[model samples]
Target: MTQTAQLYRMVMEDHVCPYGLKSKDLLERQGFAVDDNHLSSREETDAFKKEHGVDTTPQTFIDGQRIGGHDALKKHFGQDVREEGETTYRPIIAIFSVAALMALALAVGSLGTVLHIRVLEWFIAISMCFLAVQKLQDVESFSTMFLNYDLLARKWVPYGKIYPFGEALAGILMVGGILPFLSVPVALFIGTIGAISVFKAVYIDKRELKCACVGGESNVPLGFVSLTENLMMIVMGLWMGTKAFLL
Candidate 1:
């Protein structure tokens, strides 16, 4: 028998509730026949909320029992429920994943090589660019979060604001293997400081906090991922520097 679910979600002229779509998708994925109920207007949404005595939309009902919103529906299926402000690796994973794919695509298209040292270099460089873009999107927020752990950023507050730009410059140069003189030093300096700061904050001091690596709005926890980012930069800097000197 096909299980049935009713999902009440907001669908307005100017806006549509993303969670409502997520709920519907989830229901269908889980083999449920969903009766998607759209609240078309503010008045209708408000009246529905008032009648149901709920605070939010995208509410689900299974067997006539309330199942809350998207998160709640996930919980109903015994899936991981990430609450607001909870640490998540989704953003970092996504950025790196796309970067890797891009690197592979570029390597195959340009160099006709699938697995090579240059591919790895491109991956790291592209990842850095992507991460830098995230930070640059909201420098103020990123800097604020960066100040919580970065030693240089704390001592020299302006460093927090400049960090993303530096990373971006280095990444771009590294991607093209150009101006190694400028990019190499910048990458080494920032990478070293970031590694040391993260080490001190998470390992030596044991302070658990969000990583500003993806920016201020991220929920990525300060730990291995943060360390890996700094370490990659350091390695890339050294590799590029050595290659440049050898050339």
Candidate 2:
């Protein structure tokens, strides 16, 4: 009988060897025999090294062959490892710069204030449409990560499902401004969601975590301005929600 043996040496410390847990689960699920030796003390690690000629925690031995650390495990699991880039504020700064330019356009336009507001509204609607379309086009990726599909299925669904409808509704509302009664409510709802999403994006960036936002290429830190923007959106959403409910 040919016996396949898998051994794992791991330290029982918090947040260390995160991949070890994953590997253990995967190996068990795949019907591989696994032997786990937990080293809770330095003495244990030393004794393990004397026995196996390896002194590293989170090390794996397959058929008495050392497979190194986390990187090797990831490679064995068929994961594509890539070099992460140095995080910078370039992308976020660019986005804010564009927003500032739009604001400036609104400020400097020779047109009347009402016309400027209309232009701003249209611009916001178009921008939302663009983001919604991008998200929808890459629904699988975004949905799997940022959005909670199970919760959405049960209740509190994300706006992505009905993004096009919302965009169309916003466009129609901006067109005639006839339903001034409904405007605030719609805006408030969308604004609230947008704020939350932006906040989450900021949180991810601050923690140096990867996100699907910005196409996973850039890690943009969340700034105070982004928080303020979200708060403003929340206020707008509340105003709109109230109007929609009342009138």
Best-performing candidate as measured by lDDT? 1
lDDT of 1 by residue, 190-234 (tens): 999999999999999999899999999999999898889999999
Please give the RMSD to the true structure for each candidate, in Å: 2.2, 16.1
lDDT of 2: 0.52
Candidate 1 wrongly placed segments (more than 4 Å): 1-3, 12-15
Best by TM-score: 1
lDDT (CA) per prediction: 0.94, 0.52
Clashes of 1: 0
Q: Which residue pairs does candidate 1 place in steric collision? A: none
Error of 1 at 214 (Å): 1.3
| Candidate 2 lDDT over residue span 1-247, tens digit each | 4334465555656534666676666566656677876766667767877777765656776778777565676677687655467556555455446644654565566454544544554444434434344445656555444343122322554544554345445535643444645655555665566556655555553433444333323353334443554354445445444544675
Model 1 is weakest, by summed lDDT over 10 consecutive residues, at: 81-90
